[model samples]
Target: MKDKTVAIVGGSSGIGLGVAKQVVAAGGRVFIGGRDAQRLERALAQLGPAADGHSVDSADDASVAAFFAAAPAIDHLFTPGASYALGRFMELDEATARSPMDHKFWGQYRVVRHALPKLDAQGSVVLMAGALGARVGLTGAAYAACNCAIEGLGRALARELAPRRFNTVSPGTIDSELWRERPAALREAAFESFAQGAPLGRVGTVEEVVDAVLFLMGNRFMTGSTLYVDGGYVT
Candidate 1:
């Protein structure tokens, strides 16, 4: 990974931030983008000189365009940033039901579209998916569809883009900052439920998922594949 510059959207925190840290540790440079300016500042401080960042909202076309415009040529791109509401289809209003497709699915779509021109010819793109994409559950209909769309987009792009590889990483329940806002009791209960469902018998860690992302980024022969880092949960 030495000297490679990776551009990560939604990298201010959670899995995105974890990937940034690892990229820097491996002697690569990172250009991270996120909506939260303060959090982006903090992340850049933590990552030191090897990392830089821009304020970007993946949901906005102009913001995403400018974010990439300011960045130098990149060897790889990782988009782990997306925001959406999840609920049963009938319970959601039209806009609500479509939020995941708008934000999570189309958001990454915008990012990748803007990135291709600047991406290295041999560069790789890794999109984020989740266990829900493969294993459906109640109240996650829109979310699951969004993930499936992303995986399909990745595969299609792999074929269309040729040498510029594309892949998706679908992770199961991970004990990451995404859950930090939840009440302790609620968080623990959800974790317990997820643990019982997965063969690993516990939630995953950010490092574990990040490892898979790094592998996908480094493996030139891997493209059009959806790698599950879900601890057998998808099986």
Candidate 2:
């Protein structure tokens, strides 16, 4: 990662922020884009001189385009920015059910489309997928579809974009900032449920997922693949 520039969308918080910190620590520079101005500021402060960023909402094309416009040539790109509702298919309204694809899938599509001009020919792209895509359940039908779609996109793009690697990382429940805002009881219960299903008998950590991201970025031979960091939950 030395001297490489990694552009991470949705990088102000959660796993994206964790990736940025690691990239800096490994002698790489980062161009981080996120929706929250305050969080982006906080991340920049924590990252110090090694990082720079822009305010970007993945749901908006103009915002995403502008964000990438400010970045220099990018050696690697990661899109972990997405927000959507999760529920049983029958219980979800049209908009709510479609939100996952609308935001998570297309948001990444737009980021990658806009990034092509600056993305290095030899660089890699790591798209975010989730264990839900593989492990089916009563609810999360829409969320699972979105993740599966992303994995498909990663595979397709790897062929279309050649030389430039593209892969998806599917992580199970992780103890990360994404869960920090939830009520304590809800968080604990969810973790416990996920842990019981996994062979590891526990949820994963942000560092664990970030390790997968860095591996995808650095592995030249790994393209059009899906790396699962699900603690065997999808096994």
Candidate 3:
């Protein structure tokens, strides 16, 4: 990846930050766009000299256009922003139900629309979804639907985008900030329960899922495909 240029949306923390670290380690130049400028600044500092940070809100048209307009044509694009929304089908308010669509689904819609023209011919794109999209749980209809929509979009885009490969990655039960809100004991118990259920006996790490992203980045032949980086949670 030396000298290669990559752009990552929502790259301030979690899996995005992990990708930034890997990009720096591999001697690649990475530019990450995040909604939070302070967080982005911290992330870029952590990533050292090879990484750059930009503030981009994928939901707003002007912001999206400006981001791609100012961004250099790149070898790869990664859109990893996901909105938080979950509720039972009957109880979900219209606004709550549409939150994921507004951010997670349509946000990528905005990113991909602008990124296409700016992408290098050999460039690839990796869209991050979730395992819940492949299989369902007892709740979170909106979240699951948004994730499913992302995979669908990636498949269609792979064909439409042609040689610029597009793929979706579905990560299951990752150990991330999503669990940080729980009390330590509760969090530990939750993780253990998840581990007991998965055949692999544990949840995934950010490193594991980021490895999948890099694989898609490097593998030119893969497109219109979904890589499930779950710990056997969906299988």
Candidate 4:
């Protein structure tokens, strides 16, 4: 990772931030971007001198465009940004079901379009989708639809992008701040229940997923592949 420049959009926290830390630790420079300036600041603070931050709204073209325009030459791009509408399929509204495409798929499109010209010749791109997309899950129709599309998009880009690699990481329930939205007890119980179904018998970690992201970026031979870092949940 030495001397490599990695850009992580929506990287202020969670798996994205995990990757940033490792990159910097390995003597690479990381530019962390996100919608919240304060969060990016906090993230950069934790990352120390090898890190920088930019405010970016991945869903908006102008914000994404301007954000990338200012980036130093980047060798890898990772965006773990996603929004979901959760409910029964029949009960979901049109906007809720379709929002993932606009925000996740097209959001990635906007970032890639802006970053392509500036990326290193051997650069890599890692996009995130949920484990729900790779398998069936109740009350996640909208989320599943969006990630399923992302899986396809990553494969398509692998071919279109040529020597540059593009991959998707579909993570199962990871132990991250994302669970903070739920009451602590409920979140723990939910994870405990979900973990039992996986062969690993545990939820994943940001460190584990981050390792996969780094692997995808570092391996030039890997392209257009969907790596499930889901603790065997997909199995």
Q: How far in Å is the alpha carbon of 139 misplaced in model 1?
A: 2.0
> Which ranges of candidate 4 are over 4 A from the true structure?
none
In order of appearance, the predictions have TM-scores of 0.97, 0.98, 0.93, 0.95
TM-score: which is higher, 1 or 2? 2
What does candidate 1's lDDT look like per residue over 1-235, in tens digits?
8999999998889999999999999999999999999999999999999998899999999999999999989999999998888788789898988998999889999999999898999999999988888977677888998899999999999999989999999998898988877789978987887788788889899999999999999998999999888878742
Error of 1 at 58 (Å): 0.4
Indicate the residue-level lDDT of 34 in model 4: 87
Instruction: Write candidate 4's Cα lDDT for 1-235 as tens digits.
Output: 9999999998898888999999999999998898888888899999999998789998889998888888999999998865555778888788887777788878988888998988887899998987888765776777788888888989999998888889999888899877877689978986887787788899988999999999999988999998888877743
Per lDDT, the best of the predicted structures is 2
Cα lDDT computed for each candidate against the true fold: 0.92, 0.94, 0.85, 0.86
- Root-mean-square deviation of every model: 1.1, 0.9, 1.8, 1.4
Sorted on lDDT, best first, the list reads 2, 1, 4, 3
Clashing pairs in 2: none
lDDT (Cα, tens digit) per residue for candidate 3, span 1-235: 7888888998888888888789879989888888888988998888888887679999888988888887877899999865566778889898988888889899998898998888998799999888878766646788888899999999999998788899999988888766675578967975786677678999899999989999999987899999988888743
Task: List candidate 3 stretches off by more than 4 Å.
Answer: 181-190
**Model 3: which residue pairs collide?**
none
Q: What lDDT score goes with residue 169 in model 1? A: 96
